[model samples]
Target: MTDSQDHFDVLIVGAGMSGIDAAYHLSRTLPDMRFAMLDSKDSFGGTWHTHRFPGIRSDSDLYTFGFEWKPWTGVPIATADEILRYLDEALDENDLRRHIRFGQTVRAARWNSGTNLWTVTVERGVETVTLTCRFLWMCSGYYRHTQGYQPDWPGMGDFTGQIVHPQHWPQDLDHTGKRVVVIGSGATAATLIPAMAETAAHVTMLQRSPTYYYPRPKRDELATTLQALDIPQDWVHEIMRRKFLQDGKTMVRRSREEPQAVAAELIGAAQAYLGPDYDVATHFTPSYRPWRQRVAMVPDGDLFVAIRSGQASVVTDTIKRITATGIELDSGQVLEADIIVTATGLTLSALGDVAFQVDGAPVDLTQSWTHRGVMLTGLPNLAMVFGYLRTSWTMRADLVSDYVCRLLAHMQDRGAASVTPALRDTDRDMPVRPWIDPENFNAGYILRALDVMPRQGDRQPWLMTQDYFDDRITLPAANLEDGTLVYR
Candidate 1:
């Protein structure tokens, strides 16, 4: 046990994209504030460092995905190595590495009202350590890192060939000259199929349902043109950022208002890449509106190229059982494969699965409401960064970081030791809804964890719009004295 007097002013969990962003904001906004960061992983680049699967890359454009303070000079779509390098550069340039303690997994955080601080317990290797902080910032991402979601098939153990999950890909596994079957049509599956097809004898993507996919250029022509004109890097970054934000807004609106037309355009693009006679509708046309699930980006149409070249194929059928050689489909067909890659989906873990208690009482996240999409209701001096689904995650992450810094500044000015978003009497009467509407953002992982996640009310800070443009103006500029936020 350590004395509470030695605690940091702020303690940040997870040294990945969100944590690094928070640290950058803190450094710029409050250089005098004492803060430290802890990450379960041994290094930075959270997801980028963890998943070393083939063809791993960003599903969103780098201009939007990259930090607002930094200019991304690479191509629009970046590979895992490129992203890891970028993160390394960011940490070095900002000197954030000095404040990070690696291999520290936070297990529980208990808030003490008497001391106005949070006591966090973390496990580092074989030792247990406890620390305290005035504020707790959770940057740990939404999904579980130890394992991805793998459904129980009738006979998964019957498979004789090697089976792998993208989350835990074997470094020495060989795919060359082998038949591979990838299960799922999400981002991971979409990325793996094309990358594996180049070396595998034949690759098949077996999905129960189709997913919306958009072909994005590997390079950005507008950015290239601007740079060719000798435009400043900062100016180009801003221009591209705004352009992508507006384009994302328009795309989401169009997807909702004119789903059929948007669906046709997406399918038509696939036809262009796969040849005029290819049956794109059977494998690419999603039943739901675009953006309901993330629209997987196929960089430079690589997946379609592989499919057109006869190296890869798509089978839309449910698996009835797993055989020794491959999977048996409900349609009375079996796809034989030498290797099986289950890219099913991710399992959402709220706040890194850290158990939270306030004043010795357990905090049920499901009953709490979200405040401005950053903090949970009734949680004092805490903020969690959960990014937008429609746009690049960093867009919201950067904004949330800026907002949290502003909040801390306000608290300091008021000499307040604690601040919590509490529901007002007026808000209590409002309808409580799921944090997000499943119909609007029905990604499988989100739907799976909806029951355990936080809720949202109908009005103001209690509701999360998931719109960057709307949040950009409201979150940073809103009055801190709003009735919902209680400062003490």
Candidate 2:
């Protein structure tokens, strides 16, 4: 049964980092435009709110992860608590809390071409609520929020230890003086080993394969120096942001041009941290090239230090099965442990898994093509934010927000209510590719769910470029009058 009907000029989904970024831009640019934000969770912080595992921190620097308008005066790689505090401050300072409706999960949205409106169906508790909006902005992140990816390993009826996934970590979980085994070699496992080693009797990082690990200082010396000079916060932010972005670009370029040199440098850094006798080549060297998957950040070489001090150790082998005591390896080795932490990767969920329809006909996102990495082909007045993989997610989020604002202004100027990206005759025959090329990024999570995502064309506007520098320059100067985007 329908409980209520509400209307707005724009409806923004998910109040996470991307959603917050969109709200900030929309409020600043289109103040008069009637807009409302929806978050499935009760609170504002999306990822920060959900991920409460031990040693949870940002992989990217705070200068870039933090909003462009809001300067983060904290460590480069901030903890979950610090990030949450920053988000809370942003929410209060901007007065955005008033516009957000908590516990409203959008189930489906239908586009009415004749009326130039989207009828959105949201599940609010037991009753269904309907809302109409002129435009839809999807800020929900691209991952399953309720669960993390956990593979079913061969096991007996029970293991003596507590098997836990970091996503759904128990608050009262006690690992003190207990032997802990953390599975997987991603960010979560890297973070867990060091922190758990502090209290645990011993921590073992068991990995099926190696991952690229880069150790960086928690604090930025240049940022501190600029602050010491009495420079404004915004100025310092801008300077640091640009420098980091440029440095990232250089690193990517170097990785592509001189893969061996880059790999060697990374291995050398890990060897230095773990000591010369450590097996850096076996444990730290990845089979794939650098940045193929995200390079895990080890702040202040904590993981290596933990390993060096004999608090933690790394094991490189495939798991055969889970025994009552611990996991048996393919090499006929058994790891005895009291606790097992499955730090497995995430499962991808695009656009909050909402179903779409166009005047009663089902709209399949997998069949559609992306436009400027934001809007989809044939989807009118809709924008979905998917950030860059190589750099800070907020960097791309800022650009997308600016572009959407420009688009809204353009529509208003033209007195247009419907603006859709239409496939022209020239683009009809263009080669369509997967959403993200496997060659570009072969991360297990992405590859596992690539078929469900929207496709990308080989040409401009339709092509999804992961390069932040390219997007920063191209998205701003993009002509609204381009024939590809039909404004009615």
Candidate 3:
């Protein structure tokens, strides 16, 4: 038990946005505490670093996604590279780059309640390292390390041509002039189909089911002008952030209350881009309510333009099998293709599969109850910060970070050893949904987390308000007087 191990007051398991934010606050408030951040990859920015697929951009606007302390001066809808650069800048600005240990994957973390510390085991190449910390923060974003989900299709192995998954898009795999079929109707499919159409001989987007699509402008002119004019960056960020949040909230509300109207308007606009003959209902109409899952965002309607120009096409049908020469549909139709891109879907992993332990017992997250989609009931001295599917993720992440900081500060003031969400509620009749979407559809990892995540209060603190203004008050500003959170 007394093996040689580096000990820290706080140990962060990721160097991405959440980890960076935690480090920033800890450094400012608890500067005397030893802190170190470890990441599995060779760099910071977990998702931004892992996902290198073409045409990958932030679906959410930058305003709400921007950090509270750091104003995002870049364009509203930013590319993945741009976001990575921004994250790199944040690390440098806060002098957090040196404290990070790259290529160190955390295998497991065990909590010794008696010692009041966590023994973290990590793998770094050939060597295994163990570290100890008083507090552990998990920030390895979801989706299980960029591995794409590939369902076994009948006759898949029979096809001689190359099959590609979006999560592992091969850089050298040339598809020029090759008839390509992209499967799945999620965000990735919408993004890749349009971009791939430019060069592929012909592209077909095959969707197992339809999804609601909304076209968003690529650039916010007001945001760009303000940034250029040397205006207060936070001011611009705040205004634009509020506008976008309101826009998204309105869309969600309208989709729920006036599903037909909203659906018709969106379908009409999308169909106008395509021809009158294109089957919008078959390809675009989803079975769930609008905003039930995150509505796919299309900037500039590039997909629409691609379809309109006859460069790409959408096909909504059940995939029966992958024939050597083409794809067989459930309707008894076979479409020929030279190459197939299974933009199928991604496998959802729980907080990057971080192994959790309470009192030396392995924690099964599926059996745990989510508290505010950020913390877990009965999970002590820990919190997870993944965003929601319905609203901008950063909106909740920012709030959670502030709240966690405040909670830490509260623990310090009270001379408490640790804090946790206590499961002392007497209400046994409370409903419980799966920890995430159990069906494994591509509705997005964050959205599924919200469905099972706990609401703040029935009426008092207010439920998980996706709205930034309400969250700012309830999380960062509201009194942490709730009995559910205990300090000891």
What's model 1's lDDT at 169? Answer: 96
Error in Å for residue 6 of model 3? 1.7
lDDT assessment of candidate 3: 0.75
The sequence of per-residue lDDT tens digits that candidate 2 reaches over residues 1-488 is 22234888889998989988999999999999878899888888888888888889888998999999999788789999999899889989998888899999999999988888999999998889889999999998988888899888989346978999898899899999999999998888888889999999999999988988889888889988998999999999888989888888998888888988999988899999989888877899899888788888899989999999999999999989999999999999999999999998888987789999887898888989999899998688999999988899999999999999999999999999999898889899988799888888888889998989999998889989999988988999998898988888
lDDT of each: 0.91, 0.90, 0.75
The count of residue-pair clashes in candidate 2 stands at: 0
Candidate 3 versus the native: TM-score?
0.91
What ranges in model 2 sit over 4 Å off? 1-5
Clashing pairs in 2: none
- The number of the candidate with the highest TM-score is 1
Count of residue pairs whose backbone atoms collide, per candidate: 0, 0, 0
Ranking by lDDT: 1, 2, 3
Q: Which ten residues in a row have the lowest lDDT in candidate 3?
A: 453-462
Question: Which pairs, if any, clash in model 3?
Answer: none
| lDDT score for residue 288 of model 3 | 73
Which candidate, 1 or 2, has the higher TM-score? 1
What is the per-residue lDDT of model 3 for residues 115-221, given as tens digits with 9 covering 90 to 100? 87788889999999889887777777656775767779999988888888877877797778989988888788888888788899999988888887888678777
